[model samples]
Target chain A: MISTTNESDPNPNESTLVEASPRRAWYRVDDFLAMGLAALIIVTATVSALLVRPPNIPQLVQDHQTSKVRLQQLDPSAESFSADRKKIIKQQAEIESSIATMPLKGWLVRPGEWKDDPRAAFVKSDKSIATPLLATFGVLLTLFAAVSFVQGQSAWRFALGFCGVFGLALFSYVLAGQEVVKHYNLEYALWAVLLGLLISNTIGTPKWLSQATRTEFYIKTGLVLLGAEVLFNKLLALGLPGVFVAWVVTPIVLVSTYLFGQYVLRIPSKSLNMVISADMSVCGVSAAVATAAACRAKKEELSLAIGLSLIFTVAMMVVQPFIVRASGMGEVIGGAWMGGTIDSTGAVAAAGELVGSVAKDVAATVKMIQNILIGVIAFAVAIYWVSFVEPRDDGSKPSVMEIWHRFPKFTLGFLLVSLILSVIQSQGIEGKSLVSSIVDGTTKSVREWMFCLAFVSIGLESNFREYRKMLASGKPVILYVCGQTLNLILSFLMAWLMFSKVFPNAASELLAK
Target chain B: MRFINTGVLKFACACAVVVAVWMLVLPVVGDFPSVRQRIEGNRAAGINPTAVFYTDHPAMADIERSIAAKVNAPTGSFWQFSARRPK
Candidate 1:
C-alpha cells in the first residue's frame, strides 16, 4: 500500500514511500494499554491518598468502646492494668482520636511531632501555600512541557536537564511555605536572571554540553537528595511478614515492569521506556531517575515518561485506600496489602492508617523497606548502564566507557550522604535532637519540594503549542497501559497471597500474639 | 502591547530572579519552619499547609483507633464486612 507521490516537490528522501513495520502495528496495541495504565495509576493514587489516611476522632471513640473487653480478656497475665496507666492511656488515645477528628488548619512545620509541641499556630487556612505551590509548579511545568514538546520533535540527545536554578527556586518556595525558607537572603533578588532565561527561551543548552554534563548533574542531584528520605531503620517495625511482602512483591513489580517495557511494545528506546515503567511500578519519579540513568534515556523521553507516571500516581493516591475498605478485607491484611502495593510511602502510610494502626504499621514498614531498595536499584542501574545497557556496536549496547562518558557524578555524593548517615545512625550514640532533626529535615521537605520544583521546570520546558504538532501514534502509551494492568493484577495476587492466604496465619499472629 | 509584553516579561524575570536566589539558599532553608513542629506545638499531627485545608475530615482516626486496638493481635488475613445503606 506504500505509494510514492508526485504530490510534493521535495528531495528524494522526502518522497520515498515507507511501509509500516511490525513494531509500528504493535504500537497500536499499546494505545489500548495506555488507558489501562492510566486507570491503575489513578486507582492506586486515589485510594492511597484519600481512603487510608491518619486516624480521625469519631472512629477512636467507637474503637475505645468496642475493643476494650477483647483486648483485656486475651492478655490476662500481662501488666496489671494500673488505674493510672489505664486512665492515662485512655486519655492519650482519646486525645489523639480527638485531634484526628478535629478540623484544625495550618501545618505545624517544626522539628518535632505536632503532639509534642505547644506553640504551633493556625493560619488563614485558605490553602495559600498549597495553591500557590501547586500553581507555581503547574505554570512552570506547562512551560517545560511546551518547550520539550517542540525540541522533542527532532532532538536526538539521550541526556536532558531543566533549568536547575529554577528547580532550586521552586524547591525553596515550597520549603518557605513550610517555613523551611525565610526572608534571610537578599541573594534571592538575583535569581531574576535565571527566571529571565526561562522566559526568554534563549538558553541554547548546547546539546553536547547539556547531554554530556548538566542533565547528568540534574538527575544525580535529585537522586542523592532523595536518598535522605529512605531511612532503613523505620522498616524494622513491620517484622518478618512485612519484610516478605516488600522484598518479594517489590522486586516482582520492578522485574515485571522492565520485562513488559522491553518485550511487549518492542520499545526501541529501552532506557526511556525502562525509566517510565520503573517509576510507575516502583516509587514514582524517583524510580524514574535511577532507571533513566541506567538506561541512558533522552531527557525529553524521561520527562514524558515521568509526566505520564505522575498523572497516574497522583490519581491512585486517593483511590486505593477506599478500594481496600470496600473490599471488606481484614485490617491487617488490608494494611499489608496496601503498603506493599501502593507506590508513594506517605500516601501508602496514610492509606494503611485509614484501615487502622495495624495497616499503618505494615504499610509504612513495607514502604520503608521498598524505599531502601532505591539505593540498591540506583547503584545497580548505574553499574548496568556502565557495563551493559549503553554498549551499542551491532547487537551490543553502549559500553562502560560510553556510560562513564554519560554517568552523572553527583549520585556519588548521594551515596556518600546515605553511607555517612547510615553509619552515623549505626554508631548507637544517636541523640534525640540529631535524630529528630535528621528525620524531620528529610521527611518534611525533600520529596514534596523536589517534585514541585522539578514539575515546574518540566512545565517551563514543555510548550502546549508545539505538543499539538506531533503525529497521533497511540502505541507506546498503550503499552504502558498494558504494563500497568499486569502490575495491578500482580499486586493484587501478591497481596492476597501474602495477606489473605500464605502468611495470613503469621500476619494474624504478628498482629495478635 | 509592547509594554504589556514587557511587563509580563519583567514579572517573569522577577520570578525567575527570586527563584534563582532562593535556589542558592534552598539547602539552608530546608523546611525552615517545619510542619511537624507546628503539629507538635499544636498537639495535633498532620498539620502541613495542605492538610490544614481539610480541617473537617478526621477520617483516618476511626481506622487508627481500631488498628491500635488489635494491630498486634492475630486476625484473619482477609477481612469480610457487609454494609447497608445508613438510614
Candidate 2:
C-alpha cells in the first residue's frame, strides 16, 4: 500500500488517500531526496558538457570573423558581397553545429512524430525506440523504487506500481506525438492529465498504482532541473527594449490580474486565483506548475488553470496573427505583443511567424526573457504565502522561524541551479555552448518526463467532485478571461512603446540580422 | 457480463473517441489550405510553432547567437555596419 513515514502524517491511510496540505514543513525527506537526485543530474550534465569539448571552435570563430571582414570590405551592390555573405552564413552554421551536445542524446529519446500510423512514433526508418524506452523505464523504476525504500515503503510494491504509471506516461507521449496534435502544440502534459483523469474518474485509480503517483516529488525535481535551462544571458536577447517589453509588462499584468481576481471578481480560492493569474500572465504550463507549488494550490486547481491556458493558447495561436496583419502592426511590435501575451513559447513562435520572420525572432526572444520570471515569481509567491496568506487564513502569525519552516525548500534548489548555470553561461561563447548542450542533451528530456509523470499523477489523484467544487463559482473562467484581456492590452501597449516609440530603430535593426 | 461495468464501457468509449479524433478529424483540419500554408511556412523558417520553451525551437539557437554577437560586438563592427541604412 502507498504510505509515508513523515512525522506530519502519522496516519498511513491519510498519507495514501489525502493530498497533503501546502502548509506542511518545507524540508520533508521526500523533498530532500528529489532535490538530491535533481542536483546530481545537473552536476552530471555539467561535467559531461565540459568534458566533451568541440574541436577548434576558436578556429571556426576566427574563420567566420575573416569572412565577415571580407564581406564588409566589398561594396554593398557588388555581386561578390552576396557570395561572401553566403559563405559567412555557411561558416556560422558550421560553428553552431560544432557545439558538443550531451553524451546521452540518443539514449534518452521520447516518442517521435507520426502521421496516420501510430507505430511510426516508436519505429521510423527501421530505427525502433523500444530500447531507449525500455532503458528509460528501467532507470526510472530503479530510482523511484530506491526513493520508496528510503522512505520506508515497500520498494518491490513501488516498482510494481511504477510500471503502470510509466506505461501511461509513455502512452501520453505517443498521443502527443500525433502529427496534428503536435502541430497544434497539444503537449504531453495535457494528454497525461486527460488519460489519468479518464482512468480515475471512470474505473477509479487502483490503490496499487497509487503508490508510485508521487506528484509533488516529481514536480519539484523537474522544476529544479528546469532551472538549468533558464540562463540569465537570455534576458539580454533583445537588449533593453526586450527587457522593457517582457520584464516590465509581465509583473504589472500578473499583479493587476491577481488583485482584480481578489477584489473585483472576489475569487474564493486565492491560490487558484494566483495560479490562474500566473499561468495567464507569465509563460503558461511552467508558470502554473511553479505557482501552484509555491502557493500549495489544490491539484484540481492546477489542472483547471492548465486546461484553461491550453484552450486559449490554441485559439490565440490561430487568431493573433490574423489580427496583427489586419491591424498593420509592424512585425516587431506584433511579435513582441504575441510573445508577451501568449502563454506558451511554441504557440508564440508559431503566431509570430504568421506575421513575419522578424516578428518570430522578436516574439521568441521576448518569451525567453519572460520565461526567466518563473524562478522569481515562484520565490515571491512562496514568501508571500508563508508570510501573509497563511497567517491570515490560519489566524496565527507565523514567526520568522515559522515562515522559514513553511517556505517551499525546492524553490531554493530551482534558483540555485539557475544561478549556477547562468554564471556558467555568462563566461563566454564556449560557456554558452556548453550550457546549451547540457540543456538540449540531458536536462530538458529528463525534465519533460518528470513533468509528464507529475501530470499523470495529478490526474490520477484528482476527482470530478473536486473539479466541480473548483468550477462551481464560475470564477476561474471569469478570472482567466479578465486576466487575459488585461494581459493583451498591456502587452500590446508595452510592445508598441518599446519596439516603436522608445526604440524605433530596434525592430529594423533586429530584422537586419 | 457483470465485469463489463458502466465505468469500463465508458472508458472504452472515451478511448475510441480519442483515437477517432486523432486519426480522422485532425488530419482534415491540418489539410486546410490556410493551415497548410502556415505550417509549411513555419517549417521553411525552421520554427517549431509548438515549441514549449525557447530551447525547443531549433531556430532559436541562430537567433540567440545573432543577438549575442550584435549585443557584444565592438564599436563600428560588421554587425553595426550591416544595420545602417544607405544615405
**iRMSD for every model:** 12.4, 4.3
Question: What TM-score does prediction 1 earn?
Answer: 0.54
Residues A31-113 of candidate 2 have per-residue lDDT tens digits of: 57778888877777778866776667788667656755654465545657446554665676566557655787667778877
Q: Deviation in angstroms for A433 in model 2?
A: 1.8
What's the residue-level lDDT of A506 in candidate 1? 47
Docking level of model 2: acceptable
Expressed as tens digits, the lDDT of each residue in A282-383 for candidate 1 is 655566655665555554555556556544544554576677788876667677766665554445555555565566655555555666677767777666
Q: Pick the candidate with the highest DockQ.
A: 2
> What is the lDDT for A9 in model 1?
13
Q: Cα deviation in Å at residue B50, candidate 1?
A: 8.7
Candidate 1, superposed: residue stretches over 4 Å from native: A1-218, A393-409, A429-436, A442-455, A462-471, A500-502, A509-513, B1-87
TM-score of chain B of each: 0.33, 0.69
In angstroms, what RMSD does candidate 1 have relative to the true structure? 17.0
Query: In candidate 2, which residue pairs clash?
Result: none
Evaluate model 2 with DockQ and give the value. Answer: 0.39
**Which candidate comes out best when scored by TM-score?**
2
